[model samples]
Target: MRDAVGRRTFLKRSAMGSAASLTPTGLLAVGAGQAQKPAAPSERVRVGLIGVGVRGRDHHLRFLGANPRVEIAAICDVDRSRADFAGQLALRGSKRRPLIFGDFRSLLDRKDIDAVVIATPDHWHSIIAIQAMEAGKDVYCEKPLTLFIAEGRRMVNVARQYGTVIQVGSQQRSDWHFRRAVALVRRQRIGRLKRIVTHLGNPGTTSGAFINPGVWEPVQTPPEGLDFNMWLGPAPYHEYSPNRCHFEFRYNLDHSGGRITDWGAHHNDIAQWALDMDASGPVRIEGKGGFNKAGPYDYANYLEVHYTYGNGIELVCENEHGNGVRFEGSDGWINVTRLRLDASSPEILTEPVSGQDIRAYDEKNKSEEIPGTDEHHNNWLDCIKSRQRCAADIETGHRSATVCHLGNIAMRLGRKLEWDPDKEQFVGDAGANILKDKPFRAPWRL
Candidate 1:
């Protein structure tokens, strides 16, 4: 039970008992959900990959390619060079080379594809996922889930309607430390929760710094072999600029919500999970930050937002509190980051919750041992086969992303706004409500 919550915990809870339908007597069971179990071991799952950029190649492609039960069926990217490169990688040491696709729609049309892995820019997340689901394919979409709050709602609805297994790329949910911390909080190990302070690092990249200003001018022409127009997708068409594409896209408001949505998506997700608010959000939020007023990057460089949950729990989202999340309660507090887990009292880390006390989330399915991106992908795959919800289900992702979106809306508005989580709208604030959704360019509407 070392990495119990890792994969062992999942299996332990899933295998606790079997329903009558799966039992020796073979009695009909009520509400025994159905899942598309793999027909055979040799029947490999055909997967199509869209967006072979940094995360797509390093995480999705690499991990999916390593899964013996999966076949890298097709690779698609707006950039021809990237697509070709991914195709070659998928075809490496294999007799059947994966087909290369410049357009994701072409990849989605193939009946051979059972699922799709999307690592596209944030703005394109919802559209591609919705289309893929509509086309009868499960989706493994990258984090921040959507560009706007409304899009997450649409994704949740579509996922349920199609019964598609949609797993948002919030890999932290699968981490041992996070899972343990969530268990502790749920068991009241931290006592009555008082506040949560999350450090999202920065808006630009994982390096925790923004791109230097005045380093490069926007390019007049799109780079060769890159379909910049198609890359923009539903986002408003902006002139192709090297600084405005790829990793830098997170800094652009048109493409991303700066650090608010970038890192906030990850840390805020943990905060929501600990607070048991995966399906709801804060009632009031507001903050202020310094934005790149006159630079190629438009996201806030230094920002802080405060949220007031209905239960009076205060959550602070900032870029300067250092990396990770800190949860404070009346008795003690615990702080968790990717690298370390610290607590006010050392015993908090030592004390293990009993089975009855551990109530963070229900478990299901005994999956294979895989860690990091591989583990998260495997979790989604296991859940897909078992018809179980993913660790980071679409609703969980939507709520987490909504928290980030709310912070961004509050930051841009520079005023406290009352939020109606039940209705998913701002209370009597036309301007704030207007920011809930962004308009798509011609022929693109979610």
Candidate 2:
């Protein structure tokens, strides 16, 4: 059985490799060869902005301001105010401002736009991404890549089918310090990796029970100039509750995967990258948690999940210490987060990347801390022009998101699950298998 499984994996990868060689997007080549020449700054790439809320605004400003090569050609948001605000921002220094629309499809219809940046809520990610790629635009969608495992697979398929360059928004993958940590582990500089612990901080509490009355009541009217229905998109119908929308959407299951996917997307991505598990994930997962009854949320507030890989590596995900990652190996252990990198052997942080040991994507062949700016958004823009895969490509994003979903599913089911990464199924666990995908409301199909 082991031999047969190995043969199957080999065949699948071989077929994928062959197909990738003929792809026009040129993703696989970057993975296989040395970094390509830098893209010319004078050659501009036109972009369309989708979902211009908080993240959308950030992308709009960075791409339009920082990247001289990018021009914001269109902006779309269900909220009229947001769309108008984005248009104003895009027109600040330009003679011709980008066209604005309340519907994303209208923006996609334009022929001048070359790519799209999707910064919408979690539930809207897959659908928007699928549509954009189908419309012949490269995509940079925020993570976790999909709301569920099945949607992620579909997104991957659609990107491949369109031969589009799709970069997932796991920004830590672009961080120089974080990439250094992964390099150290892969080089065995940390010795043989034994285990990994990812700390996700405390799962925030929802509204208190006593506050439920006020929280449950909808505002008298939808905010001025906002299209509530379009914002809701394919998510199940619900009254306009601020807590259930916008940034607060993270707490709900209908539109978000809770903190599991929120912080999990970032930490789990680094965990998977260091473990060299970009194409695959744990064979088994188990989790335990408690939920809050006083809130509209249906997901866990606190949880600890254990994932065991086929190669004997163990990854622990817990809502305990503040957000960070720790890698334990035979020689020592290293802990890294947005702020710091510390290890039993501090030398690991300073170790140089030798000629044979440098990562393929390390264009300058610079050491750990010396790579390009740690700004993930800028890195994606740089890669788009260079025709190189961004630090967090679709495959990397999918695997990390899969890990996050697996943890959530395990905690929700209160049972252990055996996963097949290639088949993307739960073996002999019918109950858990059901959580792999959720039913999309009518008119929305992956």
Candidate 3:
């Protein structure tokens, strides 16, 4: 996924997300539950991890195991072997071994799990996270936040009703370079914002598009330890195909929104943040895409999208701007990615941002320690104790995901559509509005 950070970055910041008020054996105070005192700074938050696949087992475990502020209380996965493997990792790192659950619901029911770290496939994100929040567990869910737009709204609603501290795993907010770039733009170092542009590489290579009309990937019986049906979760069942499971799932429209949601979850999120439109989004959208093949991998493989926010700032996300977010203003433009941050004039980036300027995150004094070095993950842990909002909170994630969703919707419709950001729906188009939510396979419901 776009969020996989190299191990070396952990020295400064690892992955990004949130934490919770948890029991020594359980969780902290949920919004709907009784009001409890804020956690003591030194109190360890008990954490349950769901989806011990690559992102969860490899990166999340690596970071959480190292953070002294958190205890890996339990792990859940539809795959028994995967669950057992991650349980061992948590056991090796902590003084106590974590409990393993074949089903995530069992883990959520535990009073000992103060917070849940969800790295499940896109289709399962909304269901698990909403349930976790309802169970009084705080959350740190990986990006794309939802399989679809409506799910994100429900996740946000639960967070509000329960006062759950849900953080989206959008770690770029924790990157110092990204933080600086955002602050510079907000400080108007680039002058009045005129346009924001972004480019994500072709979805085929980038999103692992394996199902083509000509090439067929055989569907076979699931591996011995995998609960294939459970793995499918709320999504409709397709016979087991290696091409459609785990890392390869993004290419499918049912499970993901291809590059529009994959990479857009990151850059478009940065776009939303830079534009200072975290709580709101654009009012109009139009885009075009190429879906030449009628294959198992159905989402667009290529596209360009344009959004007009109420303020008239134009945001263009296409395939040619290079892989980053660029802000073009009246005076100059600043382009930023996970790599170097550059501007039309070096003098623009050199401009100092004062206390009077917008601090995308409060990184001034506390930028080096506590929530500093490991800004993203530690920011969530710190907020868990302080009862503060995380850098990439649930609502923020929803709004950003909305940008990508709108673009994808525009591509499918191939028309200019009006969106009411306040209503979070299409102005008058029933067909486009229908696309906002998806149908569940069976017992699962949004």
| TM-scores, one per candidate | 0.87, 0.85, 0.86
Local accuracy of candidate 1 as per-residue lDDT tens digits, 341-396: 78899988787554344434223311322235355776676665554677788998
| Candidate rank order under lDDT | 1, 3, 2
Better of 2 and 3 by lDDT: 3
Cα lDDT, all candidates: 0.78, 0.74, 0.77
Residue pairs whose backbone atoms clash in candidate 1: 4-9
Ranking by TM-score: 1, 3, 2
Better of 1 and 2 by TM-score: 1
Q: What tens digits encode model 3's per-residue C-alpha lDDT throughout 306-364?
A: 99999999999876445777889999999876666789998996656653346563335
Query: How many clashes does the backbone of model 2 have?
Result: 0
Give me the overall lDDT of model 3. Answer: 0.77
Q: Looking at model 3, which ten-residue stretch has the lowest summed lDDT?
A: 25-34
Tens digits of per-residue lDDT for model 2 on 1-446?
21233322443454456444322222122221122222233345678888888877865554444454567788888888888987888887665678888888888888778789898899999988998989978788988898899888888887777656677888777665566677777788779999998888742221111111114555556798878877888888887877777776777888877777988999899889887788899999999966677666666777789999999999998875666788999999988776666888878877665434435234343332332333455455545544455667787898999999999999888888899998999999888888898887777776
Give the winner by lDDT: 1
Q: How much does each candidate deviate from the true structure in C-alpha RMSD?
A: 7.0, 8.2, 8.5
Candidate 1 or 3, higher TM-score? 1
Clash list (residue pairs), candidate 2: none
